[model samples]
Target: MGTKGMDQISEKKRGKNKLKSKKKAEDVVDDIAMDDKSDTKHGKNKLKSKKQEAEEHEEQLKRLKETQAEFFEYMKEHDEDLLKFDAAEFEDDADVEAETDLEDNEKQDVDVAKKVNEQKTITAAMVDSWCKLIKEDAKLGAVRSILRAYRTACHYGDDTGDDPSAKFSVMSSSVFNKIMIFVLSEMDGILRKLLRLPATGGMKDTIMELTNTRPWKNYNHLVKSYLGNSLHVLNQMTDQGMISFTLRRLKHSSVFLSAFPSLLRKYIKVALHFWGTGSSSISVVSLLFLRDLCIRLGTDCVDDCIKGMYKAYVLNCQFVNAVKLQHISFLGNCFIELLGTDISASYQHAFVFIRQLAMILREALNTKTKEAFRKVYQWKFIHCLELWTGAVCSYSSQSELRPVAYPLAQIISGVARLVPTARYIPLRLRCVSMLNRIAASTGTFIPVSMLLMDMLDMKELNRPPTGGVGKGVDLRTLLKVSKPAVKTRAFQEACVYSVVEELVEHLTQWSYSVAFFELSSIPTLRLRSFYKSTKAERFRKEMKQLISQIEANSEFVNKKRACVGFQPNEPAAASFLEDEKKAGESPLSQYAMIIRQRAKQRNESLVESDVIVGEDSAVFGKNAPSSDEEEDEADRNEKGAAAFSSSWLPGSDSKEKEAEEEEEKKKPKKRKRKSQAEKKQVEEGAGEDDVVEDFVFSSDEEDDLFDIEGDKDEEDDVDDDAADEIAEPETKKTSKKTKGTYKTWHKNYKKTKNKKKARVA
Candidate 1:
């Protein structure tokens, strides 16, 4: 029976081992499948460790599940553009009914699809939100396959005699499946083939000549016609639904243009060439597509775009060709858009791109596009300035910009100087917004903000200021300026708002004014417009707080600037203050003690100013002098200062300011002043509390006993100087000046000056 049981136990163990091995085998299979699915053609994830793969897998799954509901809701909420092309395509009277019925059926199907998606997460529904979708999912892949299959079937299959449901399915599937085909067209994809495309002998010869030599030889008719056709092709392609959709769709993919760098380079080469030579509408549309892509993809598209800038063949010998330069300014404008993207590229790339951008912009500012003294030039300069500021902020690190910071600043500052006098106020406001962004990024932007403030101050300097915005224009006048156009830039253009916003932003960012800290100092920063918005009121309130906070911060920073090394103390200052109080020191002395203690702890060599009040009791003890000597010295100094009291000296200001000034003065100088150490030596024997009291100056200067001795010492020095020069040792009564008054000394020694000079020499 024992032998049988052992055999049975072995059998059981084998069964368990087999099951564990099977489970492990299954896990391995699943991991292999995940890896296969996760692999990209670019090999971005190939170097990742197994752990990282697992982490990414888990995160992707979590994010997918999290956004699944959102995707469904987004499908339900989304409304596609009405198919007006079909409406225009169908015009026959008999076919109108069929088309209308088809359209109604399609709308009903769309609503039903939306309802179905609203209830569940379908991978097919997520394709439309392409800007955010990056990762590949098996479910989504399966859905795409299903849709493509249905679309292909509906296209080729006998349609059951034009079934409306069949039509709807074909259209819906086509819309989603078409983007997955890696779509490109001749207009967007033909850069490498441009020279190779079949052309007549003359055309081919001219194309090769222009391509090899210079951008200017395109003056020949054949070359001009070919170039014009290219421009037409570019505009047509940019406007096409498939190209626009596919270009935008690429940005959503995880690897972006990295997989298709070759294709992207081709697209850029073709686009920039057409953009340089194209008409206004053609050029604008051409760059718009590239701009939208860059803005969405940010730095992912930067390399390809930059590669095109150098190799576009639009420039000849480092300068944009004179013929092409007419509309080449749009290239600069396009780069401005690119530079504003949320750049994640390295500093080296940013530096290179910005340098290239400056070069392109220099050539592109041809005669037609020069930033002239005109209303439109303002926007042109605004674009360039914004580009530089955004590039520095988004791409370059602060430390990286430090070396080039001032030159870059001067460039932006120069543009800002032109903004105030800019003929167009709308563009001026844009300058304000750009400056606001620059201010948010660095301290270097404050000068630009100040420039705007000056412009704002001169907004109505030349023009006769209107009575106000709401005041009726005088119809009787021969030359009546419209409020919207010619009135105060503030009242007409809403110009003051941006100017004030910039000023407030810069001030709030850098140093705070006294007005900022004290609300009464700046009584108004808001317009009391009739029926104002809640935003205005809320902004005013927030502005007030912002100003106060900034001022308080500036004050705090200023206080610590001298001893910033000690500000972030190793120990919390509050604990030290508590300890000082525990040691029975006064509140005023406690703060002084904390400051000195923190200073010493920081390994800094301590000076008299850094010593705590109670640490040097003897110095302050002599400050509180004998009462009779104080009265006598006070009486003498009062007569001297009484003559000059009205003059605003450092300590003795107006009556109201004197109290505040004395408090400010006393705190810093408390440890520095010399007092008669002989009398205060006894205070060393007293308690910390007694010494703290002896040292602190009372709030009222008159009632203050601690600071009187310093004033008397200063007064005595003045008396000694005057007495030494005027008093004579010739007679006893003259030397003594019996009354011991400066007035009495002057009267006694009236003519003794010549006698004193002989003895002094």
Candidate 2:
């Protein structure tokens, strides 16, 4: 209560003062030291988290690479052994095993199988759990591992060494589902990052950067250090995921079409690399991606993807196998699938891809390359060509594909025409059917048939000429013409002989019958019917005529070779020339005779119709008679043709006259009515004698002309024989000419004498 109390009372009085309130407010407003500390802690935490993420990504990448190595090593070293493993059991109702065929060849090693199964359990479970982690962090390495595992699982059941179909099929349903999840997560993540972008980053700094192409390209390797590269993880999961992401966001594809088509292209490039490596099993996923692009941006979109795929397979990569051609072919096929139902959505893509695929197939399977790598690549080439065939046939309306279709048809035709491998009979038959399908669909049978005919005519049928030999001729042996390129002329000849036989065998089916084609349904536009359209009719007729021509040509060839075995050695050649009244016999003539016979049977009037006859049509070779006396001589020759001259082409005019008198004695005058004569000729089958005569004429000219008759006085003998025939006509003509000359001379002499007399007078 004294001074202290008075001070306490003052203090109490001071607590009520505005100055004390001001001091309290100052204590409350202490500097934000906690906030600075908290900010520092928060920044440290963020940096730590980023570092952890980066390490995780790097570890995952390393794991993926290791897994890839292990998988390959296992495949190389323990493939067949692994098949001995008992397939892991699923629930009674879960039929994963039913979906896959795992043939266990090592039945004696049950313990080994069980051990392998036990070992796989650990890895499989690890993979299953790892895929779950991948969903949150979304690393490309994890995705790639999943992809490789997926393929390995798929190919587990595959016994065929290089079958690509095995790669697409999954052996483990569990593994496939896991890989699919990983792939979709990663792909969706990338798309979201690519499309949505960071709202507060450098993207907002520049309007051009935001509206134009994504600036993501600027941060390639540097960004990959943090985000990891999709390209490096070339596997099936990435392929499927990328496709699913792009397709699901097709509503946003316009942005890709405009500002980020390269992103789409990059995805395809990565997919192709994986495909080229033969690592990805689901190649159809990549195909769908390309096809979707074509459908969305049109086939013009085909170029970017094609270029990417081409680069992936051929550029700066170690994937130059013949099998890689199939991937390129598949990419090409993807473009041809459908831009739309309309034929107008830019055929440029289809054309470009087709051309690219053709070039790839040709270059990779170049005759030399194919020969060098044939055992390795023939099947691959066959597969690629089959894909090529399918791609070409996909274009039912060939108006847009005309330029492309012909080359494709030629390629298919060449397969059969080229030295066809006997092993390739199945391939050839497939190609033939495909070609027929193309012809039917496009209504381009004429050009296609022409191409096929030309294929037969090529000097090299794909391999070699059989030189007319038929059995076991490796049709492929005939491609190279000479020396260093080919081992020997004999080898080439054998090849050629084989191919010719194959061609004849194949073309024979088409040659004699066009009725099947007439009744067959032609593939055309979806709603358009191919029933008897003008174009369709034309196509059918052309096919029939072409087939007939091929048939005729085959017959000609067979007949030519038919006598090769029994050719009249050197001596008989001479006899064939002189006594052979029907010297120019030919199968061409035989075919003509047959055709004429058929026409006569069908309708006598049609024999005069302008049909597609062979080379010996009357306009081509017939020489009309010079005058009526020659005509009468021909008539006499025809009338007496049945009566042979016993003189048998002896050398002199006296003998010819005696032979003619004898022939006249044997001849009987019997001129039938026109209709009856026509009927008789038809009944006689248009004369096999005519065929023999034509064959004798042509064969002699082609093979034995100079060989046989060089030393013989054949010309003089023929001349003397003709002179004898006209001797009677000649004597009468000469007498008349002499009388006319004498009269003229006498008149001239009289005129001169009279003139002289007059002058004298």
Candidate 3:
């Protein structure tokens, strides 16, 4: 080797030396091979320990499994023996069928006791088997079938009037109650599925047939009893807030509503009897159930049920019961729903019944109850009226059914009649207010008019003897002495006014042209107008005083006028006199007079100077310029006079024309003078006509009484006119040149003549 090769080998040896040195450093720090050996050793130890533990656990499980199997086998054998015992308790189906056949054969032999004994034995055995199955297996289907079979045997026994043994009766009630509990427990599942199946039409026929069959009567009772018991349980569940499951079951049950009616009726009767006797909760439940039944069974069924219920209600005379009130209110609400359905005749009948109920409530209002009771009774009265109104609106027109308008009118009128004498003023007011509201909304003007007319007629028939008539009997005295006495005269008066106001308000808003036309013929307007005028006068006096105050305060006067858009005009008398004096004077007359006076003062000619004077005019004229000019001057004079006096012809004096002018002037003045003189006569005629017409047509007597102030105002106005006429003559001389100049001159002449006569006397 050369020196260079030796150097290369030395470098490579150094690199290899460095790598060996790094490996030695790493190995010295952590003993890498030893660490790996220890890790492998630890992993093997863990695996060996896990294998040993698995073997031990497996051996323990085998032992435990053997023991559990042995224990389960023993328990199974015990269950099997129990099942055998239960099976033995049940009469075999062959024996049961044979026994039924033997009983049938015995029935033909008239051996009723033997048949009863057999049925008792059979029912007892079957019930025992059911109890055992329920206790041991708890298979719902097996239990259900066994109970149904046992119930069927009891039903058959009941049909034959077979006397059941006490043991069997006890077992049957327990077994039935148990089955009911089981059914209720599974009701949500079973009933939902059962009801979801599409209905076949035959179920109704089957139900009808079962209802009619004497043999199935017992079955009917059993079914009803079962439902009754279940309902009671469900109610208890509801009270406890555990009703979710049961309510769901009831909602899905097909026969639940159908089966509820008979039971509900029975329950309602009993509940109503005990209603005030402290079973309100049960009564409430009965009401709710009946309401549900009405909703579910539809209108026809509900209507029939209500009719029967109403009879019972009447028979019991339970109208005074608050619970009855609640019950009837609920039934009324349900009937309202039925009214929304397609059946209209039934709804009309329902409305009629509601009216009857309202009448009963009206009577109850007179009862000596607490203030709250009276208030509630009043509310119920209005509620029933509102419901009846709604129901009537919902129904269609039917020929067989009388128009709902008349009955509703009567009910409202009856309440209106009652409210006045009702002890509570606020209650009376409330009832009357509701009547007014209903009258506004639903009452026809014709019916209302007729009702008002009838009331008025009754009033007339019952009116007290007046002074002119006899003995001066007032309405109070008449009512006091009447056979059927009036209650609450003040209330009756209030009701009358309220009803009148309602009628007026409705008539003002509703344009019943035909009814309005009929009313027009009856002379209600004069009476109504009189009432309005009287009422208006009271307002007018207040307003007049207010206006006078405002006028006294200039700022208020201006502000009020601005607010109300009022601008008072000049007084009529002053304006009339001012215009009258200037009537005959032309605009140009005044101007020409001013001009001529100025000219005369200035010494100028009134006429314009002409260039030529004609010889013919000098010969023929006294004051003519010329013949032709004279004619022209005369024509100008005539034209000027014509222009001023066109309203009256001149230069043609006819007696008839003069007399006509004189008559025109004289007649108007005379009429003005006599208008005041005739004032009382016109008023008397109008008043007499009004009173007689009111009596003839029998307009509302309240209106007649309230209208006195109005008639007095007319008389006052007449007297005021007479005063104005008396004052007219004193002012006549100052206004002599006016349009009434002739009348003014005549009045002045009469006054002067009177002064001369007084002086002579």
**Model 1 bad stretches (over 4 Å):** 1-241, 244-265, 269-304, 307-378, 398-405, 419-436, 443-445, 459-464, 467-486, 489-493, 511-761
lDDT of 2 by residue, 318-359 (tens): 222223333444443433443332355435655664565466
lDDT of candidate 2 at residue 751, scale 0 to 100: 100
**Model 3 off-target regions past 4 Å?**
1-138, 141-185, 188-225, 231-288, 291-304, 311-331, 338-391, 396-497, 508-761
> What alpha-carbon RMSD in Å does predicted model 3 have with respect to the real structure?
44.6
Give the runs in model 2 whose Cα sits over 4 Å from its true position: 1-262, 293-300, 308-346, 349-389, 402-437, 447-761
lDDT of 3: 0.41
Candidate 2 weakest lDDT stretch, 10 residues: 620-629
What TM-score does candidate 1 get on C-alpha atoms? 0.29
- In model 3, pairs of residues that clash are 580-738
On a 0 to 100 scale, what is the lDDT of residue 29 in model 1?
A: 50
lDDT of 3 at 17: 64
Pick by TM-score: 1 or 3, better one: 3
lDDT of 3 by residue, 286-391 (tens): 4333444454555645665555544533443323222233344344444444343235545456656666765575554566233323433333445556556545
